[model samples]
Target: MRAAVFVFKRFCGSSFRLQNRGVCDVAVVGGGIVGLSSARELIIRHPNLSFTLLEKENELALHQSGHNSGVIHSGIYYTPGSLKAQLCVKGASLAYKYCDDKGIPYKRCGKLIVAVEREEISRLKALYERGLQNNVKDLSLIDARGIREREPYCRGIMALDSPYTGIVDWCLVALTYAKDFQNAGGSIVTGFEASDISMATESPAGEPEGLKYPVIIRNTKGEEVRCRYVLTCGGLYSDRLSAISGCSTEPRIVPFRGDYLVLKPEKSYLIKGNIYPVPDPRFPFLGVHFTPRIDGSVWLGPNAVLAFKREGYNLFDFNAKDFTDALLFRGLQKLVLKNLLYGISEMYRGVFLGAQVKILQKYIPELGRSDIMRGPSGVRAQALDSGGNLVDDFVFDGGVGELGGRVLHVRNAPSPAATSSLAIAEMIADELEVRFNL
Candidate 1:
């Protein structure tokens, strides 16, 4: 039955045609949280606008949105005045409100960023200051005693407590967004894999005279959809999708696989809430940390390692095209060289059980090898530029080639993206409003 459904969906996705069916005001690609949220935002702002959302997969949130740690970031780690900071801080409140209104389950359990070494205290202080500057409310600098009070088994010289940090089932949140979008007269099509985008030489009738191009979106199954405008929230394949739409190729998406270890049920009591390490300033990834899920499970040690495939969740998973892309990218070569030692350590932890446990022991000394088994893993789409620098903030690009102003692409959205989906959608919607003169 599953095989039949998969085959039928694939056939429909490839053969489906919307060219004669009707024209839509807008089309949204990617059915993750961001895409759904963007569609919902568009509907809310312009209730009568005709819009459709396309998901390549059979269901929504099957990728990054569903595989995350479910931690609701408090915007403490991002730099002040950056898009991440602004969106995350606002997005958390919006997320909570939406969840409450929708009757979705979530937890307001706070988080702790622990500094085990004396040298980390200064860095911790800096993070605290940044959090304050970002207007992260209820943030406090805590000493070792305070850490114990909040998380008894955790040990550190000092820590930063973010009471606003919480957790939720992001997949559920995304589904709710989809429901609201549908309620507002938006259409969602699953299994529609967008393969390329091109501009129509002439604008469709009734479109403004100045609107030079109506966008044509083609999917893998030879189906096509014509719309006045398109928005892409293509998480892992964002860069490729943008390139297909005639956007620049300077910043490419690099996949990093984050593998976690779940604590044995009997030992889950050793930690409460989220416990994190003071992140290394040089890199964007937050190191391995402990996260308590809404399902009452505690997860640890999601060390980032280069993934051979963009969606490769398993260590052995490989794709010839994805692997060659990463290997041929000059930026990735330089990035690996610069972080050689750190990359080696992460790889080692992934292979060796003891190495992974040792890193976790820095915070919870009682955690041993037997206390944790393998847990779920996720792949992050880290965008890298030609200079080998990681793109630290949200990247949105459009208005290029002959399709200028007819398309918008979300090129880079990583961690906190799930947390900031709604806010990001609003930002994208605002940009579209001005660009398209809607």
Candidate 2:
């Protein structure tokens, strides 16, 4: 009671830390959109509790969050009744509002998923039904005339018009969340790569309560934070992080590289908003698409190819361990066998720019090889199970023993994670409350 009084007197109206052991209430690992949003949600919900955010990089949102093509998804692509479907729709609305409130600019230029061939019409119609079932706002099935009206140069037999889709810089949005968390008295420690999580062994002197900080998280630098609970959002290294917590590592993170091509400034006007292909249902990836960024740059492509390194963005970037891990994974082997032809083609397109352009010209006949140049690329932290199924939904887990009761792991948050970050945060916070009894 005496310590409580002193603690209140010392740091009133701010986040609280255990007086003797310097233990925080919660420690959030990773500084991407989900991590920042979750940290912000925690502080907002539990203002008196101390929260700390740790990032491996020197700055926040430098990897996936920063490299993505700035499209605010409209929930049209996700399956009905899935978390991605519900959260994406709700999160897009929340994102727009948050951007509005924060004065972060974004453009709601809309999107069109076009079907060029007759065979694709059935798939396009099925997709429309799926979008309607998912409650995607203002989604409509349009004919060839409508496609031409929306995209003057685009040729298609049918299209799904998603007017709610937009573009925003995700890196900017993530940084805003970071700001909100900090303003609410949350602590952020960049360059702290978390390497271990274990039950705390030490207690504060004269503390009546034993093991106040029951969890200790150590970084690669040997620095540590003592906290009562922990939440991890390790995007690319999520499986490794889970293993360190004594959890199953069956669903490993496999990196996929997506390369984009930027349109010449003079030709950028030819493509407005987003023009996407009717994706193959068997695959987890959306094929090459045209997207206009918030920065006024029009990008084409993002062909999916296996990356040698988990975080590698360039074609030649390689990590021996990463390559070995991916090459030996049973799930990857199965997936490769099933999609060998597609994989070979993707690899071919990666080397030859003209092959990709040839596909692009199918939609926009005026697009020439010289109208585009090599642009930025991004690496997707795709999770795969032993059964060779690509995880397309949120996957959460915890440690195996005592550590399990104290920590929660966000193992996989698939695409549209950025669009659904706020909603994802809300869902995660609910789980945190139940799992950690916060």
Which residue pairs in candidate 2 collide? none
Minimum summed lDDT over a 10-residue window in model 2 is located at: 3-12
Q: Clash pairs of candidate 1? A: 14-221
Candidate 2 wrongly placed segments (more than 4 Å): 1-22, 204-208
* Candidate 1 ranges with C-alpha deviation above 4 Å: 1-22, 201-213
Give RMSD (Å) of candidate 2 vs. truth.
5.4
In model 2, what is the error at residue 20, expressed in angstroms?
Answer: 16
Q: Compose the digit string of candidate 1's lDDT tens values, residues 1-438.
A: 011122211211222222123357899999899999999999999987889888888777888998899988889988899999999999999999998998888999999999999998899999999999999989999888999999999999999999899999998888778778877888777777999898876665676864433678888877777788999999999999998877888689999999999999999899888999999887657798999999899999799999988889999999999999999999999999889989998999998979999989999999999999999899999999977899988888995776777888989886799999989999999988988787
**Mind giving the per-residue lDDT tens digits that candidate 2 earns over 1-438?**
121111111111122232222358999999888998999988999999999888887678878898899899999878899998999999999999999999988999999999999999999989999989988889999998999899999999899999999999898888889778878988777667999999967675675798888788887867677898999999999999999999987789999999999999999879988999999887668899999999899999999999999999998999999999999999999999988989999989988999999999999999999899999999999999887789888999998788978889999998899999999999999999999888
lDDT of each: 0.87, 0.88
Model 1: residue 360 alpha-carbon error in angstroms: 0.5
